[model samples]
Target chain A: LGLGLTASPLRAAGLEPNSFEDITSYNNYYEFGTGKDDPARYADQLTTDPWTIKIDGLVEKPGDYALSDLVPQMTIEERIYRFRCVEAWSMVVPWNGFELADLLELVGVKSGAKYVAFETVLRPEEMPGTRFPVLDWPYREGLRLDEARHPLTLLATGIYGKPMPNQNGAPIRLVVPWKYGFKYAKSISRITLTDQEPPTSWNMANAREYGFYSNVNPEVAHPRWSQATERRIGGGLFAKREPTLMFNGYDEVASLYQGMDLRKNF
Target chain B: MIDVVNRSVRAIPNWVLYVAGAVPVIWLYVLGFQNALGADPVDAIERNLGLWALWLLIAGLCITPLQRLTPLRLIKLRRPIGVVAFFYVLVHFLTWLVLDVQIPSQIVADIIKRPYVTVGMAALLLLLPLAVTSNNWSIRKMGARWRTVHKLVYPAVLLAGLHMVMQAKGFQLEPLVYLAAIAFLVAMRWMPLSSFRQAFVKR
Candidate 1:
């Protein structure tokens, strides 16, 4: 916070840059594939209009709802969110979407719903990434019972107005700003209230590399890179680089699991 | 083929060689001019050029081994490819050191502390001497010392591969493939012929 220009011209965290700008412009979370920017180039072809979200498992109402019918029923609000990438980068983007708690409520969570798991549509033809066992096809993410209902969580439909760019998880996506960017599963078609710790795309691949609660803690370094420092995009060479904040500037919003060894949990 | 080769004074097709080098520069200019790469053109430039540098280095390393086995005579392009790799790596280094982060202290800190940065800088540094002495005049002037100086390319390629490995999130297929190719190149050069013979027939 002491890094001068507190409310910097870059806009406070959680504000959307624009229709084209994103809090996370630098990452390999490609909608089309793992290669960075593959989604930007190829995701324009995705169809979001005729979309369906299936809500089942521990939910009381197990049924598929048309996206149009779904949107009107959900409450939409803009929340300034701090997005932390698995990479050390951090950004404060203003996100406009319905709180996920509202949606889970709409579906009516049953008594047994302890863990809420989100799923992305897996199509080899559309998402070439799912074609190979690159990750456990159909990317998956989950949250704790309390975390699911947390105010910070969101079921994002549109970003910067209009519609969510296919590259940025068109139709609908989830935003868990406190955790690593991958926690925000994109192109959501299914939501299951599971009793177990739901399998995630990254955790399934390498649990050590990517933990379930991948909060951006500088101490818990990613096996490959350190999380201590990050590059501020467009911050020309001369501009001082910013040190990564604990929990990606969400210590206020979500720093409960402190004191305990983060390295062990990580 | 022989007659046309004679018509062209140069042993290789000059225009194609020129096109090979011009492609990256022209592509970069088009991106830079249009402002299509984004607010930070330096990252785009660094990524695009760094990848090509690694690719060309790998490609250059494959030449002699391929020549030994195949009739392609890839050795001709080795020097050209080395020079291209060196140019791009210099660009990658410059974009980060000059355009993106101007502070020398931070850059030095990154090199001294960060594993990936250290490997990347080491690879770039290794390529510098090779770049400066790449010309025919230097080769003629240095004579036998040129061979000694050029041996640095092997370690440079390894360092580049290491840099990619460290930068990736997991066991990345791309970097792994590059490492495998390096392994194959090494195998072809150093593997005892008897190892291949035993694996092929004895049983």
Candidate 2:
């Protein structure tokens, strides 16, 4: 098990994982609250045990599967990815999980499925942010069928070899390194396969600011801020902002977006 | 009771306001030095300084309304408060320029291209002349014209509030509240004196 962990080919090269303090304390989980520190303060109220994920829509096996039963069947590995936010901040995280392709194969995707939609669990009793309509409640996200089936796509279950922190999406979460961090739905409750394009929370909130395909392209700027550079979190007080790269330095995903105009798709 | 409150307010030196105003910036610097500002100290420092400036500016604007409506008189210390607020605004601008966006070209582009940055820069420019001529000598030399020049603060405050509202990610309540408070204060100056007198007489 130790040998397999160190030899994982998915580890990002020439990057250091952010300190556990920074990773756990700083998050953008709006389900908890909008402030960076609100999640750390309020997320402990979440109940993750006995959690079950409802998988339905155009799948051969459609049922609520216990997290325990699903996790044991897959081979989990460390995937150090460069996590970038649409707000122009970046961090390196060591996430441990199996591929989404592996999970989809286990359930079997119908041939006609065109998109995969994800929904976050909304428990107003525990998540205080739900009282206000900061975002349309029960945040949702989706990806193209090809994007969801990409090998780099992940369903992260742990961080730094430890159980995921409640603030950082405790039981399970999605991680698409090539896209912005918001694309990674947290504390997911339901995942559905559909033929039509599905709506995402940020895109639904403001289509002009956020697009369905939120690929990290430095050439494409957000309507409010420039994406040319990103400030590295945990780089100390005087750290200079490094120039951002296309796909957040993941050139492997470029082929996936081969002929599409990223500016329009952004 | 009103007399005692007015006398107590008058007893406090103007220098005390200036000294107290310096404490927040000094404490923020100390926190930055100790690495206690969480993961992103630059952003935290920049936001805190800007908020302090806005709060002080709003407090300075409240003096006229307070005197008009109630017996509380903080008029004597308004100059010190305005000067201290300008100082915080200057530091906040410097933090953004020096620490957050270091590239000179990018800084110039941001001021030109970004609407929020453009409005913020306009507010800072408007405050420059007012801060430079805040002393008694300028007031005496210019006489009534000093009041005209000082009136620039109304537009400056409005622009600052707009800058705050525009920069937020979503529709946040804090920035909106600041803008609303500023709008109410600015409107108070335009209200007819008869209404205020009638309200005071009734009270």
Candidate 3:
């Protein structure tokens, strides 16, 4: 899946960068399996070469764009961000990618575009966990047009100065640092500029359990587990779980949800 | 055939089971030090201890039904199984308390709000008395009441299975298999399906 490497100078969140082993091995890629190591074990089957993302809906540039053609056009930057999972675990990842806003501008979003919908590659044969119906395949995530345009949002193509390992979403993926990790779809194959809120895969599977806007809110607990605390990935067995922060500690993004009810949207 | 196997099993000291049980726990810690538990070692440890606890609980519950149905006379192993299960449960609880939850307020709130945690805690609470009373002294003092008190194992086992099912992230077949095994063992005790029940009653 290694096409080429482009260096990014743009800095984002600051935390101790987790080891490449920790970032690659421990993941929540459901297409592989629920176990953290399942992705690293099974993701080799995923063919990321010759990938094309179909940009459609309310964009002027509505066509399939090969990832090779897209990479050279943008300035890739290294963004070290704190990634928090909805399951109450976290890792600090140094991602390599350009801003999503740059890509949206390149596509020339139409005036009617209110949301940005993303879809992951649906290759059930390659992704073994898809056979179990753990989730609706072709995992979908969305961002409000404003959130999509946020400077912090990244269209990550690599991590730790290398092309992203298949388990961590090779070729291209979305990285919304302010939201839970699931909000950033991996192995993304499609991006739709839409007028309505796109139906997210997890929300479609179980709406009450997984809300449309899965912001990291400590006050609103998952039905089965508390979101108040999260264990850091590389922390040893006796390490204490740190308290989870609202918006995952990117307080600058708090203004984006101003006057909105996170509890209701959560 | 049953008599031969039973005699052989009886020859082994019961403390052997305790030692055998400790092997996995020690092995897990060794693996932990070796970093063999994979990327997230803490979560892996939490899961490993919980799974072993659930498996041992099911195995402990299976003892009576197995002894009644066959010439196994395996009742002697039941106490060791329950005691080991209790140890695993204690470790699992501590892993969650000291490592997973961390904050005392959050732990209290999780026990109160989260159904999975509540169910797991209830199961642990139910198993406490059985583990405490596993000795011959308690058995002698309680008399007929000992049997009645130990019956709590049935409910505790079911709850442990339920906790596994609930704790699973999605539609996991492994936890469901554990639940099925528990259901089958429990049914063996109560369900008067036919000759199985008659044989059990005759025993």
Candidate 4:
């Protein structure tokens, strides 16, 4: 099961993980609010205990499984990943979780399944941002079957060896290292395997700016801002922006795109 | 009440506006040094400066309409408010240039390629001439042309509001409210005082 236990090239390259305060405080969880600090301020209202993820659609096992039952069966490991936001900011996070592939294998993916769709838990009363129509409610995200099965893909349960903070998607969250941070759905409640391509929230909001496959590529700039460079969070006011790498420096996932023109896909 | 307010307004000097304008900037610097701007200080600082400039621009625009609609008069302070707004705008641009986008080539490319940056730059350019001729000597020398030159604030404020709307992540209400406020203020310039009185009286 331990396929690539080798030390991450990102860590080997001397990329220090951001302070836990930086990771927890500065978040893009729109469920809490739009401001960077909104999640830190408001997400504590969420009730993550006794969580159950609803699993259905083209799976051999389809039911509401409690998070406690799932954790005992899976092998949880820590992955240090470089997280890049579509807003042109980056952070190195020490995430502790199991691979999405392991979870799919346990659930038993059906032959007809071509894509994996995920949904975030929406409680308008708890989530203050949901009161406003900032986005279509219940933030949705998806991945091709191949991308879902990739070893790098993770459903993170904790950060920095500690249980995940409510602000940073407590209990469970998706983490696709190569893709932009928006692609990773937080505080996930549902996982569905379907043959058809699923709609993503940001792409639905503004198709011009956010594409379905939001892989971090410096060459394809966001309509309103450049993606060529990214400011590292927690870097002081004077810190210079470093040039962004293709696929956020995880070159192994480059095979996922093969011959598809990223510019058009972006 | 109007006489008392006007007398108090007359007592205050224009230089006080410039001194008042420096307060926010100084406060931001102090907060920045203390690392009190949350996790992303650079972003917080950048946004705070931009918002200060926007608020000042809106306040400057309010001067004319305030004088026209009510008995209160602040026409004498308009020039100083505008000049201070320009100063804030200049500092906001510098923050983006020096702190946010440090790369020189990317800065130039952003100004040319990105629509929001282009609009913001255009607004800054429009405000430049107004700030330059804000002094009494230039106003005396230019005579009637001075009013014509200062009229550029209308388009500058419009562009600044548009820039704010364009740069926001989603369909945010804050920037939209700023845009709506600017539009209403600009529209007020065209309507006659008699129509404003009629509309108020009808209600």
Which portions of model 1 miss their true places by more than 4 Å? Answer: A1-27, A90-92, A234-240, B2-34, B62-77, B98-114, B132-149, B170-172, B191-203
Docking class of 2: medium
What does the lDDT come to for candidate 2?
0.90
Candidate chain B TM-scores, in order? 0.81, 0.95, 0.91, 0.95
Could you give me the TM-score of model 1 versus the true structure? 0.80
**Worst 10-residue lDDT window, candidate 2 chain A:** A5-14
User: For residues B66-136, could you state the per-residue lDDT of candidate 3 as single tens digits?
Assistant: 77665678878888989999999988898788767878888898899899999999999999999999999
Q: For residues A13-128, write the lDDT of model 3, one tens digit per residue.
A: 23778889889988889999988888999999999999999999999989999999998999999988999988888888999999999999999999999999999999988999
TM-score of each: 0.80, 0.95, 0.92, 0.95
* Per-residue alpha-carbon lDDT of candidate 1 for residues A1-266, written as tens digits (9 for 90 to 100): 65446445446443324324633344454437666666776776777779999998988788998989988987788766666677655555566789889888888898877899989987767765555565766788898878788888898877655577787788898988778888999989999998888988889878978988887787776765567666555443333556777777766655457475777866
10 residues in a row with least lDDT, candidate 1 chain B: B1-10
Interface quality of candidate 1 as DockQ = 0.26
| Whole-model alpha-carbon lDDT for candidate 3 | 0.87
Could you give the CAPRI-style class of model 1? acceptable
Stretches of candidate 3 exceeding 4 Å from the true structure: A1-14, B1-4, B33-36, B193-203
TM-score of chain B of 2: 0.95
Q: Over the stretch B22-44, how does candidate 4's per-residue lDDT look in tens digits?
A: 88888897897788887778889
- Error in Å for residue A234 of model 1: 5.0
lDDT of 2 by residue, A1-266 (tens): 88656555433353678888999998998877878899999999999998999999989899999999999999899998999999888999999999999989999999999999999999999998777777887899999989999999999999999988999998899999999999999998999999999999999888999999999989987877788998999977788998988999989989988898888899
Residue B93 of model 1 has an lDDT of 85
